[model samples]
Target chain A: MSADTPPRVPVLCFGASGLRFAVPVAAVAALDAAAPAAVSLAALLGLEPHAAATRTVTVTGGDRARALVVDAPLLLRVLDVGDVVPAPVALPRNPAVLGFARIDDELVQLLDTERLLAAS
Target chain B: MTDLRELVEAAGGERPAPTAAGAATTPCVGLRTGGRWFALEAATIGEVVALPPITRVPAAGSHVLGVAMLRSRLVPIVDLDRMLTGIATPRSERGRVAIVRAAALELGVVATETRGLLELPVADGAGAGDGTDDGAAGPEGASGASGASGGEREGVPWIAREVQHAAILYAVIDAPALVRAALGVAR
Candidate 1:
């Protein structure tokens, strides 16, 4: 960790559309059960939804609360704030992404839980 | 097969040529509409977007082709060719939407294809037929600008000026004025 880097924070890691995704662990109220309400991440990202292995991660919110479906799970890891790079303007515009995080030599897109649920 | 490129080429616009000495230039995104060449100031453009599935709005008016989700914001799509010439643009993948923002209003205008940015020299006089009172319409000078007028279109007065590059004439659209007219807001 460099002097300018922020401390690591807990994130719920998962996979969808063959890409790794992470959401602030605090935003996830619970996991591994049918959500009261949910929207497929694939649908929001405009990608084909995986037919199988769709698991729900209930997100924290009120009135507009919703869940995110992750096709599979990767272990949760503490990601450094400095490791998350803001998305470049040229990338296909999606409001749900906060940025990208590098973990285990792979790029994991950090999801904005509130924006994701609001969009759903 | 339709020669899509030629069909949608900006009217009267020539391929870019060398800049004239001492002539001021402005960057613009060249586009074709109603068989006429038009350019929008590149600064006014927010981004270039693919033609998304526009949700048709009921009774919104002919100028309104509906709205589409652009980066999570629902932006109204106006058929510039239809708005300017009253002729519907044929639907094709070649069609592109230029997202423009002004006066706090962001909307999308469909064009044949964006010819990127070109540095064009301003014309010395009023545009050939782009004057306000003459109501000189473009090649497709059909009729009616909107339901508001009989012959003149709201965008007519908004023609800031004209520019020529490579022998092609382009009417520089006034971004704010265009937005106001599209929203039917009083100038």
Candidate 2:
């Protein structure tokens, strides 16, 4: 609300490998049925692979693009910058992680579209 | 039934004093993880709390279990067992999270059990022998007597040194080094 504070932005939240994650709506180009080129978000995160991904989300960052496969029932929410917390320093350096946001009593890992694509 | 404090006080007075870098009697919180005994300097520890809901991060190393919000701050929870031994600790086996701070970095380390605060004597040098002066025994004694060297263990840079108390050897974890390693900061 302050003059210096950044405004809230819309984000798309989804689940993969039983973990919740979010990314800026601007980065999400399209949401479609599972495609052959879609990559498992769980596999990308080194978690146990989930075979139940029913949707593929096409994300774009700069000139690159990647399809992230995730579970259904996605939630769209507006994220306040103040609610975001920096990732703990003890975690391994991950370019994909922007930080963590507290949304409705749940902690969601925020992702950077460019970094996620690069990681993919 | 000798008290650990009495043993530490007696040991501090009897043993050769450590160098300036090492304290004569260092207060540490004893922890058991990966079936191995370890200690974190009391000054570096903030609090011990039950494991909170953790949100796993993408592309994080295997040692990093996830990040959890503790006291409004996101603290990365490192699985001590997985970090020290290449084995994942069962969720049921995790007992507590010891919130530790090193420099400006703060994180939580999972421990199978915490053995409370202990005043342990640091050896004179980096390669000094174990502090087994009186061969005294107690309740929490003899749980882990791997016969490893007294001071620093080989190949474990994060371990500042090894100290013995009540017949148990505890690897004193170097908080700064651990924080650096956890953040992937170069030494």
Which candidate should be chosen as best, given TM-score against the real structure?
A: 2
lDDT score, residue B77, model 2?
81
**TM-scores of the candidates in the order shown:** 0.46, 0.81
Model 2 C-alpha lDDT per residue in residues A38-72, reported as the tens digit of each score: 88877777777665656788889878988888876
Clashing pairs in 1: B11-B36, B11-B37, B14-B168
In DockQ terms, which candidate is top? Answer: 2
Among all windows of 10 consecutive residues in model 2 chain A, the one with the lowest summed lDDT is A86-95
For residue B152, model 1's alpha carbon misses the true position, in angstroms, by 7.9
Local error of candidate 1 at A34, Å?
A: 38
Q: How does model 2 do on interface RMSD, in angstroms?
A: 2.3
For candidate 2, give the docking quality class from DockQ: medium
Proportion of true contacts reproduced by candidate 2:
0.77
